[model samples]
Target chain A: MISLDIDKPRAGARVVVAMSGGVDSAVTAALVAEAGYDAVGVTLQLYDDGAASARKGACCAGQDIYDARRVADALGIPHYVLDYRTRFRESVMEPFAEAYVAGETPIPCVACNRTVKFRDLLGLARDLGADALATGHYVRRLPGPDGPELHRAVDADRDQSYFLFATSRDQLDYLRFPLGGMTKDAVRREAERRALPVAAKPDSQDICFVPNGGYARAVERLRPGAAEPGDIVDLDGRRLGGHDGTIAFTVGQRRGLKVGGTGEPLYVIRTEPEARRVVVGPRAALARSEIALGGLNWLAGAEPPCRPTPVQARIRSARPPAPATLHASADGTATVALDTPEHGVAPGQACVLYDGERVLGGGWIRRAVRP
Target chain B: MSARVYLDYNASAPVWPEAADAVDEAMRAGANASSIHAPGRAARARIEDARESVARLVGADPAGIVFTGGGTEANNQAIRCSGAERVLVSAIEHESVLSADEKAEILPVDPEGVVDPEALDRALAGDARSALVAVMLANNETGVIQPVARVAEIARRRGARVHCDAVQAAGKIPVDAASLGADSYALSAHKIGGPQGVGALVLRDPDAAGRLIHGGGQERGRRAGTENVAGVVGFGRAAGIVGERLEEFARLSALRDAMEAELHAVDPEAWTVGDRAPRLPNTSMTVMPGCESAAQVIAMDLDGIAVSAGSACSSGRIRLPYVLEAMGVDEAAAMCALRVSLGWWTTPDEIDRFVASWADLRRRTARRVA
Candidate 1:
């Protein structure tokens, strides 16, 4: 009974549903079809099957593509699988490896959504003459005074707005999210009600492209000889121990330092990739009052205020939005000062801003400054 | 405008009416060809009749026909069973032939996709040991005909066996196994309006046929398992009708040319591959300067016209045409290439519609790029 807010009449409008071989997407397609709109399912084969595992660079794993085709067959909709391996490798995978090699903890999913999903796949949907592209992302798009506004999902636990912070206004206009208001349980129940075969499929875990949760191995493969042996040092530049590589550590990591003699558990304060050194210190050194952001995307109706503005910001997917002050600049850069010092702030992680539940846009973290 | 216009005949031609009827009859008879009862004899008789029809179409002896699962299996059986110490294959062959022998030395091709005759001679001359020199009668992507007769002569002089995969050339042109002088030749049904799962590997000496499947005594012990009776019957029927239609197929070159000319008129940079070489009249692989073939294919498909960017493989992904690349086409033009092949049923109106839609798509892409 969900209505897609498209211009054409429901029966005449064409909606291209991006099926990711998951139960959520399968249910989204079924629901779109049940709503009397013409639905077409498309699955992107993002990586070469020979080089990827389920958790590795394959967004649409071979089995997942088959599952999506089966779901499309059950739904009686035309389905096509486009090969996007080249685009994904260039846009998502290469940048991801580069970010890690530069000693930053990167969120590849957000970049993937920004470039491959919304940008490329949305263009393909338009090329196919579809009115809009629908996905299973648990983020709501609400009609605002000016245009469609991106918002957090009704199910706070499953909200994916943090990953979709880079969706441009043009792309937002042509995208629809049907599961934005529904809970995960309700989606699984709907799948069961529709008799979809993937109803019992487990949720995809970790990064989709890191095989067996081995992100370090994935990075090493992408960048050969990137993990050279380096020095693990303390806050005063005293060598505590030797480590395999600076890439093996991230900001705020506390375990596996191998420096057992340190009185308190030493956490990684920062990593200097060029120097090949990981600087460790006491836990308090991990907290940062402000972080500079680059590649800022503004989703607010108006231009970003040049003056410092009060807002809630989320630095990572798991953390809730916190009180922060945003200072926008002429160049595409901004700095956010949190009301309370935040921990584990690392470069390359996204800093998404919000006004209550509505996303005002975000950017990649450039640097985290200690108080 | 919404009615689908299919122009990808080189990928798989539409099944002919008679072939369809033969398949339906075979399926309805419900008698296994291996059984010994009267109904089984009737099924066997149908298969034998089809074998003769296919043999006559290709100018080969009926006794040499060994039907396999499809074209890939046929090519594999021919090369794997040749008992040769080494393999020499052309760079422009279908994946079925190129991937058959992993260690096979690849013979290079010219700019028009024709195999270098001198290269083959050198390969055969250098390796005195007996080898299987495999080459296709025609390139699948570019439709460029190969000098199979001369290459086979060189191989024969050097005591190397030759295999001509005539899957793309058999029905498109005159394919005479004896004239080509190949020890073994492969043919597929689907490329010539027959059922998809049936193909034949014709051997000059029947005793040389190698068995890839070894279960049943079917295919005269040359292949195993029960015959795909319906598929074989359809292939036979398709072969029986294709001979008389060869002249008509040759005339389709005009349609393909007109389509190319119209494309050139729309985009001055449009160029055709293998135009200087003796190619199949039905195929035209054209490249427009700035248009990506994948985008063109999608745009054409949306307009209800079916074409392909390269050889349509099992994965349904459009790869840069290795055939074009081997022919010395640069990556930019290769990425922009689209293969628009015509068939016996392809009408003039369909070609016009495709040209119009393609020109519009080109303009749209150009504007977007600007």
Candidate 2:
């Protein structure tokens, strides 16, 4: 029986599965339908697939939509594709461009999951009279003493808990993640077992809207002339070299600096967008012991402004969570004191707080504190 | 669990049982229309019979009727093969017409969703000699009827060719190509309870233009490719059935009005777009205040009803509500509106069910947000 921690039994309970034209979501839908639930598959058209693929002529349905429709037909479940272009451009794409211009390393996927996917799509699922909204994300929701708790996936390497730290408690209560307990390989096998069409499909990589992996090009197109000419400077403000623009660089980056012959291997310290300057230094100058965060979402159900508490802090999705002390404030902000110095922490990244595999909650990085 | 009530007739209506039987019989008796054998001659006769029926539906010369793949191809052929240097279409035309030529000029509309006649006149004053003016008889989103006769008069008086896309209004209303004074017009079959993948374009001079497809001598050299004998037969049968019962649309309009009134009674803030304008009898664009149209559509579908939104196509792609936006409706309000189109198969019980379920949804979502 696939109760899914939902209030109702598996039979006749409606579940809306967010299908992304991928294998993981396909398996998720397969599992729900096999358990005798009325599963409805919903795919969001986040961008103009026609423009992205440059397909010409009278065709409106894209290949991704076609694939999703095929999977739905194979699974014998009803499917829908909702247009979210305007919503996505407003909530995710615009913020991504502005954050890049402000010299921050923005995580667009996180913004997508937090706003359009979780907040808006969840509302649609509820309106559709669905008992719950399920996704293929590798995160778990277990019944805790207080209520449902957001925890890490069973497969640590494929865990996506970092990107979903901004989910509110109310949203989580109506959500289900079926792939959290399985590894990627096991997911592929399960998909094959269920005879899913996308079982052999490769995983999607990089940013979805950014074509050809061209970040600077995408930013320049979004905000014309965003990559203005600027000067490269050392920590002491000594001019090193002239560059095309700061949009092409991020904190802790070593490539494309053009100042390769500096004594030790040079790393980007930070970008001053207002000054049109790129600051570079040795690797040691990039170390930060404290980080400030804003727009906090706390799932621990505890009020803020509490005393500094010990927890694991993850600054980037690529890095593992590290030992740290969390000092939360009442005004949707928090500061994390790392027990050991970490390198290359950038603004606009998330500092997710975790307590041994359980996600307490997290916020966006505002600035790195110098120790 | 219950019988599904399909209200998305504008997308594609349920095929009539007679048309289905015609198609099934045609498939059993297989022969190419182009062949010279007795079976082939029988197939050719069937196609000619279909052509006459399609021609009568639009009051066109039977010889001027040209069959194509579907409404989209008919539209592309009208605008692109009309031998006009400049193409101008209304802002509310279907995607097929609007995207036919990248440089085609777009004419605007008023808040009532009608094309501005004065604006059309001013636009064609200088280049009407080389222009092809295209407008839809009715909008697919709001079902607002355009002043096609007036537009055709302006375009023809100024020496410009006129084209009309009657895809949405053909079977629902009385449509005669000559009455509207259009040089050419295109319409679909499935919209009138016919088979998909088939449509016809009524041309003023069929022999003067035929460049859309060019491999075969079928369709009187106006279009190319072997004839879909079964599809054409089904279309002819459906057209005959739709033509005899155009009077029933008045009753559908009454049902639609009653449902809208009941819906407004439940939620006073809801909007009925283009209600004050001359519109199709069975089409309604209902806007639920503070609710997303996608959500409303999904909710209704779960309750065994089918509706739509301009923002989401039948194929499930998310599109901008450009039709409503062209009428000065804000994007926020436009996204909150859904399209409900009734057809020949709609029942009074279905309308009652829709009203009841829609009211239940309003009650469910009426809570205030923080």
Candidate 3:
């Protein structure tokens, strides 16, 4: 096993592992214990399964809590299950629904990482006298010339740096990612070698609060009457059909248009939530050459670059990074100029700036400009 | 195993050595009390002896003691056994009694968490239907002792039966069922340093207290299933010792008072719950402005001090305790509530360490908020 670089002596360094009852986190906890560090497992009960319907493929439920406790017992470590329902509901779930209501497709996981996991749970770890907080995130935190730096994982396909772009520099210093340098297969093998009970547990998919991928249902509950009927119109301003809710459609979406026979394929260009209208057009309309960003969070020392800097930007979690020039305005707003026109640049999705493999900064997309 | 000091006795007290020995002895005997053999007779004898000891602690007759699985079961049995069409329970009663009847009337309490006697009289007069009144002798969270005799008098005039949940008050205070005028009183073993999983419902009239678990004629057909001999032995031993240690346990109030005084000295805004009423000497619920209970608990636990929040959700996140909320504490102060309950084994050094740690936390929280 590769040795951990925690600050204190291995025998007494208290390490708190954010266990999610998954194989990855369980293995991370076992690795911490095996490295001769005192490992304390903590799992956040982020939502009430009764309040929000339990999704089959989602995690962090009652069963997951039980599984985490069993693993903690097997490892002979102290474990605590903290109730984070109110925090999660306010910070992640509520904002997610409101974002949809505002006609923006928000990434709840990014918001969760920014607020619940890093901010709240990190504070809890500090309160518990833990030297460092470790998670199963497949992202690397390596020591740089100045301090710790966030980078893409060795398993490039499973890299989660996009969702973690908003992690502040101070938090990065106290965070550890044990699965950062290993492949999923190797992690599974390590879980098997360590005899973890959740070794055979399936990977969680789907938004946890949205049961069975019922995003619209959750949104309706959060913002009552959010799914009001709207007009599905084309770029020419002719109504092709009547639809239900602007939140049901996102930019560049197809398949559920319900507008029959337009002679050519039409994609959602944008959703106007105020007017309660969804505008569809040819796929070319979805391409954007520039995007304005807001709520900028920079992972830099002292100050962020005020001048335009050339970097690669990822507009979506699954999309590859695109070459872009980030122009930082004095008033805290930023504009990204894509070297080549990128497609489906939507508002509310993160524009994460990358310098090769290192995450420089990120901001929420405010507007996509078609030039 | 470490040098951690446990101050959350209201949650569960540490098991005493004598109780452990009794449990071990009974477990070794391994006899069913229902059987007619010599071993079964020995088990029966132990169970009856435990019953007598438990009764003696609460000033009830041995024949009136009916053992149940736990305190919750005892309370449940008493509440359900009262064959009344309606139930009137104190708003501050434990969940076991509060949830016993779906439509149970809630009697309001004052700022000190004491049930108002006039409200019971008024409520009883308003409702001509036969009702069962349930009120806890002492609250688990704030340790405020309630007036059972007054409630009993009001209920007696109105032809209602009264059930007093003495789970928290039995060993900590002078609990005599005859003086309290409670038709039924509940007792738990674990709260007084016995093993868990054993408690008794002491009744004034056994016939009126209907059987909750009916199978074999155990506890004179009040509660059934073969007796938990080991658990009963531990409960009896713990109960017998608890009465003798009342004077000893009374000294915990000094430690509790010192801690509270130190807390107020650190943060003048720090407030104590149920300070105006008669309360159990060991418990103190202190609220510090702007410092959340969950964070305080974690910080104290890190410092090798064990305590609990006044009100916690199922996920263990601290919420405003309903008792405090009912007493009209604001959301901000309620969220900041911390409960520290001392017990027989809590030491002065431990109390000092806890107070220092708490003062440190208050300073840190004050700094962070600033």
Candidate 4:
């Protein structure tokens, strides 16, 4: 049986595979069915970008849904497309826009994985009589002493544990990630072996709702006039240049500043959305060794450790985890003290703490303080 | 797979053996009806015979029937190309009819799922341009039969035309387009025991039916594409055979009534939409307490039974059927709505099995919630 840690007999167990029309999830569905379990593929229509949808002038399903259905048909599994546009807007898109308008560079993917894809889908899976819900995420749910533990995927390069730290313990128990151990090449090869049509399909990049990675346009559409003209100031608060919209710039962003007269390359130290000021300075100003976090999902246990917990802290999705000490409180908040100074520790980004490969807990970066 | 009970006939009835045989025969010896050859003449005769059967089913003359791609096309033909400058469709109409034009003024419906003739009267009052009023004979979601006759009368009094979408009502109940006092009625064969992709527009003046699609002299210029000959024959065969089994619908209605009663017994709060109003005999749109329609449908499918809710979403997403919303049902209750529509072949034992499974599901759900 394609093994999941669900507490049911594999022969008759029904698993709802959240198919994303990507090669990884397609293989996950195939593996579950091969293991003698009833696998049902469910693809959520998260967004309807008219061009990608099966159009008839309604809240339509995008091309991803069609791809998922085709994969399900090939694997001989029952498939369902769920309309989640409203839920997605409420849980992920709205907060993301609000964050941008508040002068923060938000990682909406973490918001999605923690809310719509896990919290709500877990409820739906149980309601559908599924023993467990499986997804294509490249994170592992390992059996722990107390319960299931979220861990990094075996193929470190494809690991998504950094973005999945907000998954609660109970949610981790009900969730299964079958592609956690497989590399990108291995998953594509498996898809080819299973005769999946998406074997050669390219990986989806950037924010999903941001078509063609045009974040500025997406933000403008979601929050109109978010790109209003603003003043670019140095660390001393002297106006250096005028720019359009605080939404276009991010903390520690090097390019697109458009204030070329400065002799040395300048990085965005911070953005004051209320004042409509873009603070530019030397790259050193972006450094931070102390980080305050909020909304922690402490997966190791019911409560945070009383003493400081040594861990590896990851401040961004693209960055590697660095050595740090976590001081978590009972109020769903924490402080990650990095051993060495880290650069570009921006607010609204996820701060994931890891013990080796195991994800201990994580929270959203509320503020970053320089050493 | 075990023996399954298909309770989603309103979605599309199981094609009858007679219809299948007719479709097969027509496909085997395919020919263009416009040709002068013997094979062509034979095909034309078959099409005409099918048209007569469809006309008889709707109580219209054969000349009033114009075959189209499907019920959607027929609806578009009746609602869009009617030469009316203003179109007003009922709020609870099928998406195909509702999407004909975005500028269409919506006519309201009462709590009983009936279109308000008074509201239609108000909307049509003092309209300078010619107008068309489109309302369904029976809603596909709630199975509530609208007062299309009263609506037609209101339209006539206001010097406007009326079009009836009788796709869901024709087989489940007796439907006569001529008696409904409408300018045209849209019908689909698949809603009965016929094949998909075949439907007809029955108009008071058949010559007015082909305005949506323009081409050759086919369908008397009401429709101009090459005919779906096999589909047409199947539709006719199903229509001809269904008339003999009208009494079976009465029996199925009894089964449906018992099923709803069993549902209420399972969960006291559960209720069927439009229970006090006239509805299709085969359909029972029940609200399963504390459950969403999508979850209920998926669970039922897993239990080897087929039921449905929501409209025809080719994309397969489950959205709350707007019919109940139009009837002023709250969003929560609307999400809980489930439609169980029986086919002519549905047996009493199958109904019992459905009830048993439903009771088990309800118990499990209630226990979980508690």
Please name the candidate that would achieve the greatest lDDT relative to the true structure: 1
DockQ of each: 0.39, 0.54, 0.37, 0.63
Candidate 1 docking: what grade? acceptable
True contacts kept of each: 0.23, 0.60, 0.23, 0.54
Model 4 over residues A1-371: C-alpha lDDT tens digits?
35897667786788999999888898999999888788988888888776755555665666788899999999888998877788899999999999999988899998998899987777778877788999998988888899889889988888999888888888888899998978988889999987898888889888889989777788898988788898999999999998888888888998998888878999999999999999999988888999999998889988989799899999998899999999988888889999988888999999998999899989999988778
| Residue A365 in candidate 4, Cα distance off native in Å | 1.2
Off by over 4 Å in 1: A49-61, B30-37
lDDT of 1 by residue, B186-270 (tens): 9999999999999999989977887899998998899999889999999999998888899999999998888888888888888
Off by over 4 Å in 3: A1-6, A50-61, B310-320
For candidate 3, what is the recovered fraction of reference interface contacts?
Answer: 0.23
What TM-score would you report for chain A in candidate 3?
A: 0.95
Of models 2 and 4, which has the larger DockQ?
Answer: 4
* List of clashing residue pairs for candidate 2: A83-B318
TM-score of each: 0.94, 0.94, 0.95, 0.96
What lDDT score belongs to each candidate, Candidate 1 first?
0.89, 0.88, 0.87, 0.88
Alpha-carbon DockQ of candidate 3: 0.37
lDDT of 4 at A156: 87
- Specify the poorest-scoring 10-residue window by lDDT in model 1 chain A: A51-60
Candidate 4 or 3, higher lDDT = 4
Q: Model 3 over residues B105-210: C-alpha lDDT tens digits?
A: 8999998889999998888886778888998999999999898998998899899999999999888888889888989988899999999999999998766678
Residue-by-residue lDDT tens digits, candidate 1, A79-192:
777777788999999999999999999999998998999988887776556788999999999999989999999999999999999999989999999999999999999999
